[model samples]
Target: MDDADRIQAASKFLLQSPPGEINDVLNDVRNIISDDDSLQAGVLPALREYNLAQFITADVPGHQHQSIVSDAARVPSGSSDEDDEQSQDRYWDPRSRTSFRFDHLTLETSDPEHVEPDSESEPFRVALENAALAYLASHYHDGVVSVFSTPGSASRFTIQIVANKYNPNNFWSGRWRSEYVVDTGAKQVTGRILLNVHYYEQGNVQLSSTHSLALALPPAIAPGGGAAAATKVLALVEAEEGRYQASLNDTYAEMGEKTFKGLRRALPMTRSKLDWDKVLGYKLGAELTNSKAGFSAA
Candidate 1:
């Protein structure tokens, strides 16, 4: 097809395409018009459209879709045993692995019975939610946070951070969902953080932990004190959030370094490592030759 026709044809697919498939279309276009700078320029709009498509396809309503094409494209190559070992090691790195998320924050009253805050506390509750949203917007990078509160029940709120990835060909899968439920009364915030990590691939490992956290809110913000109150609330919650985020980050590192290792050994427990050359020579072992698990077999 001519350049205009090709660009037109490509835009149709690109606009409707999901995040995974966008790169495919772009690659095809580049291959077809490698030397044509002007043609590439014409295609920029379609590429921009792909950016918008991600936000449209995000799993959570308010979240921005994070494209994993670049990460997934980093498939390990070369036939050396050392390269294979290095690749395996890289797989366990938490950042590269497709896992874990800060799901949401559930709010509760300070009462012993753990009921929702009183409706009269609307001003304070809103102040809290606004502070949280601001904190998340600035601090969290991978996902977006949103607030969900019922009309009459102004005291109860569910502030959530949603992020997800879906690629059938990816080796790593599953989710580590973490949520915090805290009491909104008083500056000394106390709450429980719940974690549930369930991995579908790489030995189907699962890990979980629940713990309580407390932080003293920053000074200067008083309950129902309007804008000034909101600013102080932001700092207060930000401190608590920093702590909560630190806990989750530490847990992820532990999962990669210790928890996952204990569950699945990359190498057998023997003193000497198995000879990969011999194993790859066998028919079944031939499949291992392909860095990816199912790709070579298929």
Candidate 2:
């Protein structure tokens, strides 16, 4: 088969095959590409195309991600640069809708919020994007609970949750409080629930402390979805805590076969519904931390 056909076969195998049987899939592709030099010729181009195809148009609520489907279509199957057919340096980030021209040393990306990758917006949003939000939100939550942190990491990860003042059901909260009862019936809960874990030098060792988030339960939660959503959410958060206290100790992100360890064991001995809070309230230049937490909540 030609390069396109061969690469297509390999990609299909990798995606469709059973999860643990990748070595076998590689072996099958190895035999095909090894025999056909032309097929090999198409590998990099096809791989790039596939890489671009891997992303779908995403429209995240509080944020956005890059996509490449449209640009990939522009390049066509088994093709190169418009100006120079031989140049393989052409690439685009679909999320950013940005094109890169290494040969010309140019970089361009449209605002994800502004441009449409396709004539019509794709129906479904990307799962990974939401997964990332959930992951980061959980991470933000964890960052607050942990005492010892990677140096300089505290500020870098603290992100602001967006506030839509216009929406009657989803407005923003004014004050940041440590008490879990810091809810004000917001139209929407759109901020980080910061648990500003304050570490103070109590002589030979430093004492770690805690903090808060302004939470607002959604309308759904107040009505019927509370229990089901709560179960799912609290589980997610507890999972995150266990992960932070365990694997997060060193920073190699992992999942499955969960375990828990020191500090995490005792700290909030209760399982409050994780869904009770929407996210990390990241305000632009807003301080959520309180005084005596050793850092100025300025």
Clashes of each: 0, 20
Q: Name the best candidate (by TM-score).
A: 1
Query: Once superposed on the true structure, which residue ranges of model 1 sit more than 4 Å away at CA?
Result: 1-120, 141-185, 247-271, 274-298
Lowest lDDT sum, 10 consecutive residues, model 1, at 102-111
Q: State the lDDT of candidate 1 residue by residue for 177-243, as single tens digits.
A: 2233323444454444444344445564444555566656555445556556656645655566567
TM-score each candidate.
0.40, 0.23
lDDT of 1 at 12: 70
Candidate 2, poorest ten consecutive residues by summed lDDT: 143-152
Clashes of 1: 0
- lDDT (tens digit, per residue) of candidate 2 on 1-298: 6766777777666543221233445567777666555544444444434323222122222234422222322322254445443334433333343433322111233222333334221111122223334644654442111001111221111112211111113221111111111111232222223221222234222112222323334444321233343333334344534543564345323222233343354334565534334445533213444333446433
* Cand. 1 Cα-lDDT: 0.45
